[model samples]
Target: MLKEFTIQTPSEGFVTITKQVAQIVEQCHGEKRLCHVFVPHTTAGVTINENADPDVVKDMLLALNHMVPDLAYQHGEGNSPAHVKASLVGSSVSVPIVNGTLYLGTWQGIYFCEFDGPRQRKFCVNIL
Candidate 1:
């Protein structure tokens, strides 16, 4: 099953969507399965990372910004850095679903990485 969700993201930061993903996973019935979370935006992506410490998110964004410097690109849009970051981070994450729950580590959580402006974004969840 595939479901879409909307989220308002910051100009450039990570938004923890663990709870929302979990809620979606809970709806599936029977046996162990797999869950895929996908972000449908060029400047956005999804990842599974440490969410217990807020600084982790900040550090990740800082590192990404540092790595993807604001340099001229062939693309007319000035959001080349965002596109690079999104490519580096990837657009989807897969997690194991056991007993209708996400089987993530204690500190691991699902995050939506937004590298562009504060805009409305859409992500999808697929249960298989």
Candidate 2:
């Protein structure tokens, strides 16, 4: 099964979508399955990380920006850092679905990493 949703990111940061994805999984009838969440944007990505603390997300973004600071790049769009960060963060995440629920850790949550945003984004959830 497949589901898609849109999100509007206010700025560059991690937006938790764990609940949304879990809701989709809950609607599925399967007991055991693999849930694949994908971001189909070149300048954005997906990940699973500590959702209990907002600082974790802040630190991650800070580290990424420090590592890939915005500077002159060949990409004329001026979002080369976003592309690099997206590649490092990855475009998708897979979670195990058991008993029709996402098998995530206590502090883990799914995040949509927006590097170049304050814009509309779309992500897809595929259960198999």
Candidate 3:
């Protein structure tokens, strides 16, 4: 099954979407399944990471900003850093679903990564 979800993001930040994905996964009727989440924007992506503490998200964004600092770039859009960040984060993530539950670590969760935003975004989740 495939579903689309719309979300609003800050100019740059991570939005946790674990519960949303789990809600969909909960509907699946099998014990063995896989959930694929994808963001279809060049400047956005998806990932799974520590979710127990909010600081982890902050630290990640900070590290990314430091690692891909803005500088002179040939990209006309001037979002070269966003593009690079998105590439580093990737556009999709897959989570194993077992016994109708997301098989993530206790502190792991799904997140929508917005490198350049303060706008609406869409992500799709496919369960199989």
Candidate 4:
């Protein structure tokens, strides 16, 4: 099964979409399956990381900026850093669905990593 949802992001940051994914998993009729969450955007991506502390997200963004500063890119759009960050973060995440629940770690959650946003984005969830 497949489902899609939209999210509005800030200039750059992480948005937790774990709950939305869990809701979709729950609707799969309590089957044990694998869920693939995909973000089909060049400047955005998805990942699994710590959700209990905001500092982790902040540190990750800081590190990415340091590694791929916006002003240091050859791309004319000036958003090459976003593309690099998205590539590093990846565009999809797979989680195990068991008994209608997502089998994520206690402190781990799914995140939409928006490197250059302030725009509307969509992610698709595929259950198999």
- Point to the candidate with the largest TM-score: 3
After superposition, which runs of candidate 4 have C-alpha atoms over 4 Å from their true positions? none
Local error of candidate 3 at residue 27 (angstroms)? 1.2
Relative to the unseen true structure, what is the C-alpha lDDT of residue 127 in candidate 2, on a scale of 0 to 100? 94
TM-score winner, 3 or 4: 3
Q: Between which residue pairs do clashes occur in model 1?
A: none
Question: Which one wins by lDDT: 1 or 2?
Answer: 2
Give per-candidate clash totals. 0, 0, 0, 0
Model 2 per-residue lDDT at 44: 96
User: Residue by residue across 1-128, what tens digits does model 2's lDDT show?
Assistant: 89999999967999999989998998897899999999999999999999998999999999999999767799988889999999999999999998878999999999999999899999999998
Query: After aligning candidate 3 to the native by TM-score, how far in Å is the CA of 13 from where it should be?
Result: 0.3
lDDT of 3: 0.94
Q: Per-residue lDDT for 1-28 in model 1, tens only?
A: 8999999999999999999999888888
Candidate 3 is scored at a TM of 0.98
Clashes of 3: 0
* Candidate 3, 1-128: lDDT as tens digits: 99999999999999999999999999887699999999999999999999999999999999999999879999998899999999999999999989989999998999999998898999999998
